[model samples]
Target: MATTNVREITIALRSDGEGLLNSLVDELSRLAQEAVNFMKRTAPKWRSTLTNSIRADKISDFEWDIGPGVEYAPAVEEGRAPGKGLPRWEDPAAADIVQWLATKVFAGRRRARRTSMKAVHENLELRDRYQGLAWHVRHHGIKAHPFAAPTLDMMERSFPARLELAARRYLATTGSGGAA
Candidate 1:
């Protein structure tokens, strides 16, 4: 199994007092929430599971780990290269793919078929769809549809502004309305 690590972004504050630190912490939390919301909107959704899995883990006073929570999250975010092989399901008939197959592809107008109760073999379209997907995944591999890394990129670009804003808030609260 290949791996995809979440992109890292850091915000550091070395304040001697709690007031400035509080401002920085609040700003980090806001940035983390923005990142999560951006990902939930931009990520490729699989019944909203992938999007809902996004969270922010507070790593320190000023840093956070923001990304998805699911196992196949990296795969969904980064996409699988060709020849990654099909999913190793013991029984394709009762595989988790039934619900996935039931979900409509977001980019299209196709109606979702009700395939939850039926076994793969019992439904011709379901069986064919699963097998076709399996074959394609095994051969062609999944194309990369990245969102997490790009989100970090976007946030990093605006980091200077965010940091300045935090500093300004701190200064305002302390009545030191000078340069950050």
Candidate 2:
């Protein structure tokens, strides 16, 4: 699932200070992963719906496609007289699953679109920050925010303060001030 683009993006995110930028990236990542996990969990129901919606004709050996609304055919009794001993029709769970998945699909698509928009806004903000940083550095060499003593101290302290210290170590190294 991991791609070269992921590495590139991580590298790009790290090439800056101001920890908030990294925090935005991390939030987006979490939303993307959660949407994917939700879809994966519902995938089996989708498959079952597709499979159960088909019908096979024995005489012509031709299969016919049917919608989920089709009810299961009842079994024919042989020479014995039918006395209503037949089992009750089994309730098809496919309809419920399909409906749930449809809802999920809509919700997932909406979430993805929202996430995309948020990322676009985040990118614009980062672009603005980079531009500002460049302007500051050009005007005043070895700027105040990049190597600020308090900021660096806070970045160093971030590790022991958080449970997932190792995973977050990359934040400080990336110049993300442990924020990203």
Candidate 3:
């Protein structure tokens, strides 16, 4: 089977004091909560499927580097350029790494799906909808928030119930005299 990949953003901080670990953990817990909240509003899949399942403890942190002698700017946009509406990154260097990771993740997902029989067998409309997500991630990357419509996770979580509900409705309308 072809491989699938996901990009996870990581950052590192060097601390000298004993209390630093506690401080860092506290901050990361806050960040995880923020991430969960963001997902709920932006990506409802998390709400319906993973709402109670997720917590700060479930988030894992790892070390990463901006590298030696690097000057970093925050991810937020600061000033606009003459032609560009908002600078892609306040810190160009870190942004470059994040973009690269996102690209790899997108490409890997597409390649894996292209090779999968299930992906090939789906009807055009369904395939298009699914593949469109792959392409969207490839081109624009997955948001920290859900900007796209309901995702695969959402569909998987809710579609079965939806399908069953529709089937019941259809049977109710048709009754026993309806076409077999």
Summarize candidate 1's per-residue lDDT along 63-96 as a digit string, tens digits: 7899999887787777877776665444764366
Residue lDDT tens for model 2, 6-88: 65556656564345345544543443343333333322233354324323222321212211223321110011232322211
Of the two candidates 1 and 2, the one with more favorable TM-score, higher being better, is 1
State residue 129's C-alpha deviation in candidate 1, in Å. Answer: 2.7
Candidate 3 lDDT over 1-180, as tens digits, reads 543221210111122223334444445444445544543454324114333433334424422121112122111112122322222223563344344444544554543365577555533434344445445545564334322223335545654554445434443353421111
Worst 10 residues of 1 by lDDT: 4-13
The Cα RMSD of model 2 versus the native structure comes to 31.7
State residue 70's C-alpha deviation in candidate 1, in Å.
0.4
lDDT of every model, 2 decimals: 0.71, 0.38, 0.37
Query: RMSD in angstroms, all models?
Result: 10.8, 31.7, 25.4
TM-score computed on alpha carbons, candidate 1: 0.72
**Each prediction's number of clashing residue pairs:** 1, 2, 0
Model 1 accuracy (lDDT, Cα): 0.71
Off by over 4 Å in 3: 1-16, 45-47, 50-180
Best by TM-score: 1
